[model samples]
Target: MMHNFNSDPFYLTRSHEFDWNGNESAGNGIQHVDSADITSLFSMHNGIKASNASGSLQFGGSLGQFEKWDDPIVADHTSNHNEKLVKLAQNREAARKSRMRKKAYVKELEMSQKRLLQLDQALEKARHQAAKQRHSIGRDDAFDRAHARWLGEHERLMDELRSSLLSGEGDDTTVHLLVDAAISHYGDLHGIKSKGAGSDMFHILSGTWTTPAERLLMWLGGFRSSDLLKVVEKQMQNLSLSEEQLVCIFNLQKSCQQAEDALSQGMEALQHSLTLTLSSSSLARPSSGDVVDYASHMATAMSNVHTIQSFLNQADLLRLHTLQQLQRILSPCQAARALLAINDYKARLRALSSLWLARPKE
Candidate 1:
């Protein structure tokens, strides 16, 4: 029947012979059917029966051809989607790491700010302490200068007396009595006894007095010239300090003392304040604005310290002027010695001032 169908050109039909169990026997002929006839067969068969019979019929191509047509397009689409997913995951991880790095940088900046603030505060405190020490040294130098001037005057007087006695032109008995009284008075005042009781006057006249305070007082009390004493006394009376001037001088002394104490206390307070600022947990993390405020406060405090120092310097100048005026009443040699002493003291003070000024600040 298949040979007859194949021999006919217009219609081709191929049939499969099936056993009674409805299964096709081997080699019972797979064959091509015409499209119209296959359509009619499909119309007669239900969907399940058609699918089962599909293998027996010949189509244009096998099922593998359809899969081959779609495979490259589907594979390209899947490759592109997988690449997109991989790129998206990489970008997400990168973004996360970038955020972590940014957070670390911010933390480092915060720590740096805190460290700088601490350094600034420490520098300010060091400056305050240095200023305080400078003022204290200035006060001490002033006192030393005054005392040196007194000692210089005493040495000058001793020299003058020794010269007069050695010349042997003065009243010998009166000079001897003056020397004895001066020595006794000086010893009593200084709580010191002359080492060589009998030779003390001779030693002083020979310019060999070794005790500084005793030598100074002996000079002070040894001047027995009634004429010179009268002249000095009259001059002193003429230049008698007014009650108001005396009070001012006394008040200046008190104020200087108080300023010294105050400066000491102020330095302590400044240190305490800085300690609190640096050591406090809350203040240790100060912001930019807080740092600015602290700097301003330190500037104000430094200004006040300078003002006090200026006043102290002015007071010292006035005291120096007063000493100069008093020294004028002494003999030329004595006055010159006193001035030299003052100059020496001033030199020392200048050296100290220079040292303080040159000290390195934080």
Candidate 2:
């Protein structure tokens, strides 16, 4: 049979020379083939028979011909193949999310490490600062201790100096005499000149007195003079003694009438006394005891000057005389000059002696 069916060109077709049954004969007259028999023959036959019995024939399956198709149908097959592509894309997106999360985790760890490093640096700096502060405190404490020790030593030295000056002991009679002389001069302030540059006995002892005791004694005598003078000035001011009143009070002892005559007589008398005393001392050498007694009397006389009993202190006058007598006896020695310096004894002697020499009336 030869038939043409054309709904789709890809459907099967039958040719005239092809055989339907398993026979060598071709159909002679119009054969009445049942549809069922034809269907059965189509099922049993394969290859050439299957090709001939088909209504319209194609050489291969649609899948086999698909290779020769145009882009549209080819794209349809490619589209079907790409179904798994969506799954691949979803997997790639998941991997990307995982990688991004890993990077973010790594960054966080780096930040944490950096922060730890910063903390360590801060801790080290704080430790160094604390150490420096401790060192500074130690240095300050050391300085304070040294200063305290220095002050203690200074105070000890000053105490020794004060003690040495205060203690009156030693072997220099001439220096002692100088000291007594200084004390006498100071004691005479109220009666004599109230304020003068007034000698510092310490300077005089160091400069003038050869005797050790006398020098030390002289220093002791004047050590408190500057201080005493302050006290006296304060007392006098409190008493409201005017400057003119002070001058008048001082002049009273020198206000005797027949002034020039009295002065001449007095000077002559002082010179005579000096000559007599020197002559006697040269003949009779004095004992050390006599010299010592003379120093004591000189001290006593000086102490009595300008005291409350200045005019009527008979004991003080006797001490003055006794000191003069002893000084005369010791005049042969060089140390005798130290005694004479006391109370201006040498001058008094010279004036008395001169008076005797020039005396017209006995």
Candidate 3:
């Protein structure tokens, strides 16, 4: 009889000899597996059978279970994410290095400008020293002329004494007379007191005592020596006045200093503003590699504007003040003469205008 093998326990297979396909014979002449019973056994095993399969059936020993799939598309997405992170890190490092380099460049430029200013100051000092030396040389020349004249007069007196004595006409009276006259004449020529205990060469040369020598040199007429002295004193007064002229020059110097101060302050303000702009742009925008070039152009324009404004406002004020001071110090005619010699205000204004026009526009 045909039995239901799907639900029959006799249809179950526990060895490779189980006739899953119902083709094997039992030990007795009765067929052990019915079609319905075998179907029940297959259904009980979830439609899987170990026998009558072409290939060996794998049974959950490190295989034959649903696999956890490794998706290639997901792996590509993770790789791209890591690459972007690395690129961002590299960009950050480059930007930091560029900022450091720009800072170093600006510092170096400031140092160079400071050194140039010091050099200018040193040069000015050297010129001042040279002027003083020149004045000193003029004084020395005047002193040398006076000393030579005194020495020549002394030699002449000695020659006269020797001739008179060799001619047998010199007596104690002559010697005394000659010595008295020599001393008197020396005192008067050099403006020394005849009654002084003694006098050195310098005191005799510079002393204002000419009465005694004038009386002794009566035979030579009242030598115009006093007139020569008056002239010398006048020259010394003129030298002193040169110092006054130099004081007037200080007006110009003060003007220059004020102009430079104004220019420096304006430029410093502009530099600060430019630094702020650069910092803001760096932080607010993505790196586009063109910020540096644009920033440089803007910085140059700002610096020029600051410099021009300083010259227009502060330098013009200083220049006008200096001009007023100069006018007060010099007569109208003298000022015109001097200004004409130097090409005058019109030329100066023209030159300034030309320079301003040549500068780049904002």
Candidate 4:
């Protein structure tokens, strides 16, 4: 009575030698099972266990065998995703920094504009006040005395230079001292003019220190340095200058001319700007019923005029440098001659002014 179940997973089969009473052992103790069948049964049992543990076979191999096959692909996808996240973060940070820079730049620009406006207003107010009152802009009695003293010194030095020239081999030391003094003396005039630039802006801007004849030749705020070079050249013609000296003079003249041209252009532009500022109808736009901002307009005009002082300063420096350089190029006697030539030219202008003034008027 052994069971025969071939459909079962265990594949148990009954022994063919068993009797109906299940007493195969009645005659021969027990029926002997085939060793090959036992072996096949145990092999099937082990195969089913492997299939259960690994969730069935796949393409003739266990499921675990293919598990590592997709691991490399998953790892690659994860790495790519991390890199994208890093790039996105970098882009966001860059955008944030750029926005911050733009904001700061705009803020600074606005602040600068505000400060510039304030400065202009103060200047305009100061100029207006100066017109109503007498301010000591370095033009006190002491300055007048100093100016007179400077003129006398100029006369004395010129006389000494004349005496030195009349003597044989003119005093080189006197010539050197004269040039040095001339150069140094400009500082006093420059300082006085600078003081007046802010307090008496119009007077300094005009040829206030010059006679009418001198003013006729005035450029910017004073005489052009190039004109002085011409005088020096004319005076040295009798000296029979060497090629090097002439070339040096010509080069200096060219440089002075170029500088004058540049300053002229700048001054023209500044004049245009000042004209617009001064003549702007915003200060008197009552007809339009719009509120006028007088301070703003005046400030702009004052600012432009203030820049004229800087141009005057540069022109003064050019004249000083021209004289100093010319001194270097000329011999002591030649320099004395140049100095005398300049004085004579000035005297001639004064004579012309005197004759013009004395002319019979209708």
Of the candidates numbered 2 and 4, which has the greater TM-score value? Answer: 4
Number of the top-ranking candidate, with TM-score as the measure: 4
Which consecutive 10 residues in model 4 have the weakest lDDT in total?
59-68
The most accurate candidate by lDDT is: 4
Each prediction's whole-model lDDT (CA): 0.46, 0.39, 0.47, 0.69
Report the C-alpha displacement of residue 274, candidate 1, in angstroms: 44
Query: lDDT of candidate 4?
Result: 0.69
**Superposition error at 308 for model 2 (Å):** 58
Candidate 3 Cα misplacement greater than 4 A, ranges: 1-70, 139-362
Query: What lDDT does model 3 reach?
Result: 0.47
* Candidates sorted on lDDT, descending: 4, 3, 1, 2
TM-scores for the candidates: 0.23, 0.19, 0.23, 0.56
lDDT of 2: 0.39
Report RMSD (Å) for each prediction in the order shown.
31.5, 37.9, 35.9, 25.6
**Deviation from native of the Cα of residue 243 in model 1, angstroms:** 68
Q: Which lDDT tens digits does candidate 3 get at residues 176-248? A: 4554444444444333221121222222223222223233332112222222223323333333435565566
lDDT of 2 by residue, 1-362 (tens): 55543332233323233344424455344434555655555654453355555533323422121122346878788887798798899999999999999999999999999987866666455445443543454233333333345435534433333333346442345444543443343244222211111322222213121122223333211222222223333444434555664564334212322332343355455446545544554235446447765555445444433231222232223333333333332322222232323323323433343333333444
